[model samples]
Target chain A: MAYALMIHPTDNVAVVTEAVRPGEDVLYEDANGGQVCLKAAGDVPVYHKIALRDIAPGEQVLKYGKTIGVATAPIAKGEHVHCHNIESPERKELI
Target chain B: MEFYGYRRSDGRVGIRNHVLILPASICASDTAEMIARQVNGAVSFHNQVGCSQVPSDMQYALDMMAGLAANPNVYGTIVVAAGCETCQCGMVMDAIAARTNKPLHGLIIQKEGGTIRLIEKAVRLAREMAAEASTLRREKFPVSELILGTECGGSDPTSGIAANPVIGKVSDALVADGGTVILSETTEFIGAESILADRAKDEHVRRRILEIVERYEQHFIRNGENVRLGNPTPGNKEGGLSTLEEKSLGCIHKGGESVIQAVYDYAKPIPTDVKGLVIMDTPGNDASSIAGMLAGGAQIVVFSSGRGTPLGSPIAPVIKITGNDATFRMMEDNIDFNAAPVITEQKKPAQLGEALYKMVLDCCDGKLSKAEALGFTETAVMRACNYV
Candidate 1:
């Protein structure tokens, strides 16, 4: 099982500890020794984010229990979450 | 809680007893470098600003130049200048004298007749200061006497999850022990301003926190530019930072969970009496940001770099830590601490923090950081406006 980490309880995504290939099982451990797993929908590089649930466009991509960005496209659970699918809302006003 | 350090005449403590060869303008930087090279325990960096700058911009350069010399890390300073420069050697020398009654010497290229003669005089001055500096033995001082500067650059996801959080633990430990810690890089605080403000020690600090963020944003907005245009740079993106908010949330971890007691402008001195965590308004550029903190009287700095860097300060030692095992393995020559085991081996961050705290104390006790050992004295000063 590939390991991942959820920095905060409210964070909607987790960071992979190592590169996970498509169809791999990404396991996340909690402080209480509890474990959660999600099957990787695609290749996710180490230190990259993976969605914990389906996210709709315009929805906040939560990490560290805060909005990192807004999803720009449909993202299924376990899908890679990166710049290609999410954009900074702050940039919209200026650019 | 105690470490060996040099106690300055100003009642401040310093980890290093360096003789600073300070260049007041760009024209004298080469001479300063040559003089420092000839003297043991002498340091100097290229100063690109000073001449041809508007008064406001020149003030920043002058403040940095003087503040650096005043930093307790320096045993004394030799201020070198070209006579025609806007930042005169006398002005900088006076600024340093105002900050502390430390030993100071001034020189001008025109008075000395050229670079060769100036270098000869400066080298003699620096040698005398270095000899005096070597005579003072280290005395034990409490860690509470230290003002620590925290910074992060070349960030990634692991930095937020591991290295920064580990630094957070150290921040809390230091603050709890009555030391001062500085959290800077206003640009990185863009999306996390509210979060930081909520932890302010009072309404004044709270309002100042928000004000600095607003001011930084407005400054960019007025220039017909947006901070998001360059933040979360391509490297940050590749390291899994998709937005400024994500990067900021990671960046603020270096401040730890302590309440912010005060806020300061760029390169201003951090008063010795102010304890606990404080915020310094600074740009996100690595070298310039570190310069601001060092000038603010930070005796030492802890810098977290996920991608790893070899950057060092001319005035103080910078301890580089990283959370990426790959980066740590690849750049061990430059990086001093490895926080990657918090992810790979599931080691506790607090445990690693304890180890890191020891390393910090060791650094204060005279251990040279990898960057310092390699003689990496990269320096830069913040500029408020363009040249006239």
Candidate 2:
């Protein structure tokens, strides 16, 4: 089965093991080591991120169990997560 | 726990014994290369900076040049200069002498009448030095004498998950073995300072960790640019890394879980008394960062690259490892090890780390790495500022 990898249980995104076309079902190992399936809502490049859960605008995007970036717009489950929807911020506004 | 290495007069063990044709300035670089080509077991690098600049910038070039010559990997050095450069041959010789009492000689292009004459003289000196270098036999040394430089570049998501973790395991093992490991690239530590500081051995190191990151970011911030705005560079973004934080979190994995014992300035000598993990303030640029570590006396570098790179050091062997299965297969000629099975076959990172550790031992015992075999000796030294 095509798969993605959820690096941490708290991570809202998982990295795709291979490219996924829209509507394709991709499997991912959950934090508990159990496999879960999600249908991709959009295409994602290989090694790119896929939304594991719905994310609202301005909310931090978690990967490696930490804030990798913040969403600039709504990100739906199984949607491709990348620069178009995210911004790597300075965290605390520059002094 | 033991590897065969050349025992230097300075009491340091060297994994390689090449004679170095040192260039004191950019003007002398080609001459150094020309001399190196004629002498077997001689190595030289293209020096981009030497004749320019403010005192601080000139000092960096001087330190790096001397450090490369003083690196235990070389049996001797023949410093070549254009005579009128800011970094004079005599100054470089003094710097090298401050670090090691190894065999040393100097030649000036103007004094020798030009490139051809200088190369002729340097080639003869290098040939004699190479002969002496060849006489040394590899002797057994404990792993504790080794300093491992850890770096990651051309990274993708797979690097953090597989390759860096595998290197992390090796870092931990080397620390456990009482060997020194250098965690460099301060520019990559932006979003993960707290995590690394948490692993510091004491308040001093923890404070230094924060200071170096602040200093690096401020250099950009003071110039009206935010480092976070552009990091996770174009290649990093294409490789699935989204933020400086994500990249940093991955980059820190190369340090394993060892507590940072100390932090050294760029191109400064890594004190021999220090053991375990230390951090060197360096840029994120692969060649420059690796060059800083090598200058600090690292005998070997284990670099993890998910997007793949051919970076190597002239003085030390750089063992390239990749976690991306496709990249490894595609760049088999450049990459030295593959950590892809961690994802493809679900093998443990620790297991792969043991295998990589053995490869490091083999490299130290005189096995040429892919980079060494291909003769990729790209190097760069970090500068304080532009030419004055």
Candidate 3:
């Protein structure tokens, strides 16, 4: 019910505005006038993102209504999104 | 909207009232500081150059000294010199006179007999100027009277996403209201120069933008460093920025969407009535760049950072904003506003931009920024190395 933020309509993730511990309940608006329960998969800090839906490899990671990066592998909903899975193409090219 | 500010004799408005003690060269710096200490409202910088080689470099120092005096913030100035420096006190005083008819006094250490004698003369003159400055009062001035400077440093990934864009929005708003905004840091515009050129008001301005970037690249080449290989610094890489191009793209966003009006040399005062966004050719060093803008007559500065820095100028107040929420939390004492909400909470950049614009008005009306509160009056004057 707390620490949830909808960053953009096109974004498949919502950022965690404050630190949220693993197993905490994050209630979000669902399509059927019901609250969908999302359990945090790991501790997330402010400005970090959480997967709103199952993301597949190579799928564009949207934030601020733009593609911030592409997911490198399948990420479960509520899992923390960061360098481990989402990597900037520019950085990838540098490697 | 309008804010209360001191109106200068040259028709420019100043956000702060100051009595400036300017050193004509390194030898006069100590005496200038002594004068500032004796006078209640006087401030001086530790100038390290002025007696050097090339005429161009000497002229640069001389122009900056005069520019600082001509800057609207100072009601009057006391020019101190060693009598034989490349930047002579008389030349500096003449430059200030040409710019404004405001009260200006000159003192030469060599001509005045000794350091103690020069200091005594300077302190006496500075006190008279400070008293004269105190009599002047602030009047309501339109927002269009402001010439705002936009600069960013210690950039991280969130800087491109939040802080820069918020400043872009503020730039657009100010331009729409008929104000002038100056965007500098030629090195940061390397990869994105073409995009900005495309936005230029004409072909000449566009070509000049590219020329300035290329000139900076040549400066690096002369120094024996590849521009690309040295950019997107180690800290930037750690913060998720990958290449120089990516950083350049984000950096240009702070200039907003206005058509580029003109480009200028470092520390030269901009032509009044050139309302819109302009660019100044300056190095990427934050302190030097901000100093150039302040000398060029920017009444206030809006500085963005991802890794926060507590930088301010003795004359102009610097408002610090940050994009990274973590950095903001870690360095809350240094940062003035948080733009992380734009990324973390989906707050529109416009909302933060409006807030920053209102804060600028408040700052002009005598509100002290976080940098001012922390007493971070940092200053740096650019110089060239020379051998005798």
DockQ scores of all models, one per candidate: 0.54, 0.58, 0.08
Note the residue pairs that clash in candidate 2: none
TM-score of each: 0.97, 0.98, 0.81
Give residue B83's lDDT in candidate 1 (0 to 100): 89
Cα RMSD over interface residues, candidate 1: 3.9
Off by over 4 Å in 3: A1-95, B228-230, B383-388
lDDT of 2 at B5: 95
Candidate 3 per-residue C-alpha lDDT over B190-273 given as tens digits, one digit per residue, 9 for 90 to 100: 657777889999988988898888877776677787666666676666565545555676687889889999998888888778
Position B159, candidate 2: lDDT:
91
Q: Output the better candidate (1/2) by TM-score.
A: 2
Top lDDT prediction, candidate number = 2
True contacts kept of 1: 0.73
- Name every residue pair that clashes in candidate 1: none
| Tens-digit per-residue lDDT, A1-95, candidate 3 | 45565545667876555667888877655445456678988876554577889999999776545555678989889988776787544322100
Model 2 fnat value: 0.60
Ranking by lDDT: 2, 1, 3
**How big is the positional error of residue B259 in model 3, measured in Å on the Cα after superposition?**
1.2
Residue B269 of model 1, lDDT score: 89
